[model samples]
Target chain A: MHLLVCGGTGCRASASDSIVESLKQELENKGLSDEVQVIMTGCFGFCEKGPIVKVLPDNTFYVEVKHEDAVEIVDEHVIKGRQVKRLLYQDPEKKQSISDSKHMDFYKKQIRIALRNCGFIDPENVDEYIGRDGYMALGKCINEMTPQDVIKEIKDSGLRGRGGGGFPTGLKWEIASKNNADQKYVVCNADEGDPGAFMDRSILEGDPHAVLEAMAICGYATNASKGLIYIRAEYPLAIKRLKIAIDQAREYGLLGKNIFGSDFEFDVELRYGAGAFVCGEETALIHSMEGLRGEPTIKPPYPAEKGYLGKPTNVNNVETFANIPVIINKGANWFNKIGTEKSKGTKVFALAGKINNVGLIEVPMGTTLREVIFEIGGGIKDGKKFKAVQTGGPSGGCLTEKHLDTPIDFDNLIAAGSMMGSGGMIVMDEDDCMVSVAKFYLDFTVEESCGKCSPCRIGNKRLYELLDQITQGKATMDDLQRLRNMCEVIKDTSLCGLGQTSPNPILSTLDNFWDEYVAHIKDHKCPAGQCKDLMKYVVIEENCVGCTACVRVCPVGAISGEKKQPHYIDPSNCIKCGACIERCKFDAIIVK
Target chain B: MSHIKVKIKEKDLNTIKQICKSFNNEPKELINVLHKTQEHFGYLPAEIQEVVAQELNVPVAKVYGVVTFYSFFTMLPKGKHPVSICTGTACYVRGADNVLQEFKRQLGIEVGETTEDGEFSLSCLRCVGACGLAPVVLVGDKTYGRVAPDGVKAIIDEYKK
Candidate 1:
């Protein structure tokens, strides 16, 4: 019998480490240590009910296991062969305990291709990775196939880049292989800078060896000797795990020189990015890896012809490489049969923001947004009304409830005015103001713009100012037209992908939530009540019991009332802090 | 990118010089050197940038430009306890703004500023990849998940002593 404990950062934060130790201790005391094996694995992707412990062979899954329950788990589940009824995952709506994850709604719809081995194997242990057919693809590429044949297989699989831009991966490899350079390089763009996106980081933390093996296969295909992984410095855990995986692969003679007794030699090095969001662009990422300011120059020299000290280089993001081994193991035709016509594989999403199941999820391409948000994500949090879902980070746009039934793919999302940007599906409820949401993304873009081009630097700043004005109830309807025109100008003239798509939030929100913007402009009212400047605090006279609770808690002394009389709030002095609302027990304070 | 007038110890200066040498004093290793130096020191001050520039044979203005361009690099020192609140999309929808305001009200400082006693500092990070714990707050290395605005004072009080 085996007990798999979640060792991801989320579970670790919830003290899954102690639960692992306690489980081990209890099993040893029971003399079942020889019979039961305790293994710590990566993220289960069901983080809403994390610190998950699953007993294998019988497939008994436990949710939210506390430290003290470790002894009971051993007493009931291990020794006596009985299940812990309370520890099982109970459905929020059904109120029935689920014994297996396969039957759960969260896991039933998720087709785990990129995350196949994430929660199943111990990442730090390379042998465990190999046990799941890890480096077999690298061996197969080196022994059975030539460089051209490998690229042909990738082309046949119709695998496109998973890094926002859906450029064909095979075409990129072919371009780099065709270029004649003495020192070609393979680069992995692990600098995942999208806000609310953790797909790449989770993959690296869960299965580091998959990325390394794929990079090796990439090296054999592209005739590259040195590989560099440009990862963000913020992801210290992923970096540490990748370092371990690299050292182990080298120690096992799978990474270094002449792998599988062939005349192919390749190795990978790590380059740390210093928190630059613009570095997600390939050229900027290349510049950052070279220890520069991470600013992008125009393409056409395109990393393939001249990259990394002026040598041919191929760069693929972490998720794209995670799929390579699978495509090689299962034939191209089998892999290509899934997903939509254009986008031929699955996409991993960091499903968060006002959602019931806040976690990482991988679903096949062309899955409707409704199915992802409702079926897999378990619907909106707190049973709030659905407003919109933002995909592709700041560079992407917001889609309303009308677009939920639209199939999610590269072309389809673009047609709906959003793109499949590195799969950050942030679901927003009715509480979120569409104007404020656009302003929020603009604020991010304004800070992250590299100042390389005039349109991006100045245009984004101007766009942010207009949104700020709208939120503050100071904008005229003329400013709306200015915002729309400026978005097109920036999209047309920006230097990198960052600026070209920076105005997506504004464009998308304006297209879908036009009425909300008009309400903010014409009536000077924010329907969402999110904008502080537009909100007014008033005491409902009928509900006020004159308890003086509001007066006592008002920070600026903005509320006044006589003993046993209705209270009044002086709006000018009220800082809009909402302190009075919290203090009011009689429901006297109303915000309009 | 401007520098403050401050005295620097010779030993600390040598550590900075030694780090540059380890990278072969290459101009392209500026970002890597900055990352390592920042790891050694809590934050990068003007004196450290000057030493790095002198070692790498780059202009002082260029090093400052690079430092200020990236949000990761900081010119000021952090407090004994650095508190980073995630304002990612997940956290924002869960009312992280209120949580941030509560921390600011308690610390008497803005997002990037440290308290007068240097006991605590406030900053905002994009996402720490722990969205399951939305509205997450981190004091030094310990993470406080599902933080409410009402709980901000207790978090600050725990590190006060």
Candidate 2:
């Protein structure tokens, strides 16, 4: 039996490496090392209970396994032929032990098309990747199908770019192919600059071969011989794995000239993004690859027509490319049947924020927000009331309870004042303030703004200043009107996607939670008490034990009382830092 | 300003060539060249940026835009170590603002400013994705989570050591 240990970056940080070592030592100690093989693989996606271990052949899944528990697992499960019931994942809802991953609610709803090889294969091993039809797509494209045929297949598959824009992949390839250029290029926008998004990075880390093969296929389809992957320098692990995969591909005759003994030649290279959010845009991304300032230029001659060294180019994000091989291998007709008519196939989301199952998830296109949040995400954390879900990172908008059942697709999301951004779904609970959420996105846009255009640079700044005023409880109703006006102007006048969609959070929150803004302006009160400037901290006389916990923790010296008496918080001096409230054992300090 | 006609200096050119050679003519070496040039010149200049594009056989526009897109990179010169303060919800709730204030007070520079001595550059991040250990500040590669206002100096001092 083989013991597959999760070696994904998340589990790695939690000393999953040590667990593997300890398991090896324990297996040796128990004289079961020869019988049992330990294999380290990528993420299982059920990260809420991670550092996981699955005993293969029998498929006994163990969740939240620590370094100390390695001995018990080997001793009891490996040697004795008995399962470690305690080490197994216990479903909180059912209150029963789950032995296999297929039985878990988190895995039940997930359709792992893009992430098929993520949990199963060793990412660094090229042989394992090939064993799962890794470079077969490249071979099929080069030897069997022509550039036109491949593009037509992608068009038939109805594959839209997964990089938030949802542009037709085949159409993009066709544009570049039709454009007459001596030197054509294919670019992969791996610069995943979204705040809560790690879907691209995870794919690169887990299945770099998938992207490499897909890029090769794209090169054949677009008649581009060279490809470049513009990834952020911050993703050291993803970069390393991608480099290894590239080198391995070249060595295996899959990357360099005469690939799989075919005439079509295609190879991929990497360009490191300095971590700019705007560079994720195609025009800006192409400019960055050309060694220029990573700023977006106006479209007339789009990137497909005049990109990279004034040559015809096609650019798609990492997740978009990850879907290509599947579309080609499984046939377009099969993929077209999965999701909505317009948005075919699955979407991979970095499920984050207030959700319990906070990890990477790939669900079908038409899956509702309620299903993603409750059924797949395991609902809001700590049984907190669901407030709103922020889809599409900084570029996307917030969806309220009223829009929970709205099917998540390219058109549906856009209709709801939000776009399907690079698939960053940050679930927010009732404790989260909607106004503050708008401010948070605005702040990100303002900082990342390239200052190339007036609408983006000045407009975003003015909107942020307005948000700051609103959060500080210093804004008038006139200011609210100005904020909305500014959002519309910026959305309309901005040059690129970054500036155009910068007001998404503001518009979305304003659409759903207009009353919250009114409450902040009229009542001068933050309902969630998130805006500290508008909140008041008071001591509950009945609950205070006067144990001096608040006194010791108070950084601003806002609380005062004798050891035995009820402690009083001086609201005038209090900065609303929440230290006293957190330190209060008796729950005396209450935020009003 | 004057289209500068900015030809690569011999020394800088040699450095660029050597860096390009190290990556073995792979177009992917464009970022490495830019990074190394940035390290040499403090920030990416038009001349160095041009040298990189020419070396990698990539467009100059592509290099320039990439340099501006990412937060970790800079076109302007910065101090030695970048000290980034986490201002996410968890960190903000735990008095990260005061910690940032303390850094500004101690370093005599605001967020995104490099100290006069070129010792440290302070900046604020959305979140480093480490919330359990809130109020975090990252100096170079070391992350000091649960950092208080009073602990800022000591943390910087430890980095110095």
Best by DockQ: 1
After superposition, the stretches of candidate 2 with alpha carbons farther than 4 Å from their true spots are: A28-35, A541-545, B1-31, B37-70, B74-123, B126-161
Q: Give the Cα error of residue A395 in candidate 2, in Å.
A: 1.5
| Candidate 1 lDDT by residue in tens digits, B18-78 | 9999999998889999999999987888888889999999998888888988888999988
DockQ scores of the candidates: 0.76, 0.23
Please give the lDDT score at residue A379 for candidate 1: 97
- Assess candidate 1 and give its TM-score to the true structure: 0.98
- Pairs clashing within candidate 1: none
For every candidate structure, what is the RMSD over all alpha carbons to the true structure, in angstroms? 1.3, 4.7
Show model 1 residue runs off by greater than 4 Å: none
lDDT string for model 2 (A1-592, tens) is: 8898887666665667889899999999878889998877777776667778999899999988999999899888888889999988888799999998888888888899988988788888899999998888877877788889999999999989999888898998898899877889999999877776677877888899999999999898888899999988777778899999999999998898988887778888888777678889888888777655678999978988888888888999899899999888999999999999789999998777677777778999999999999988889878989998888888889898989999899999999988898887878888778898888778888888989999999999999989888988899999988999999999999999999999999998988999999889989998887888899999999999889998998767888999889988888898776768767777888888
- lDDT per residue as tens, model 1, A1-592: 9999998888887889999999999989988899999998888988888889999889999999998999999999998899999999889889999999999999897888888899899889999999999899998999899999899999989899998999999999999999998899999999999988999998999999999999999999999999999998988889999999999999999999978888899999999988989999999988887777889999989999999988999999999999999998887898899899989889999999899998899999999999999999999989899999999899899998899999899999999999999989999999899899899889989989999899999999999999999998899999999999999999999999999999999999999999999989989999999999999999999999999988998867999989899989998898888878887888889999
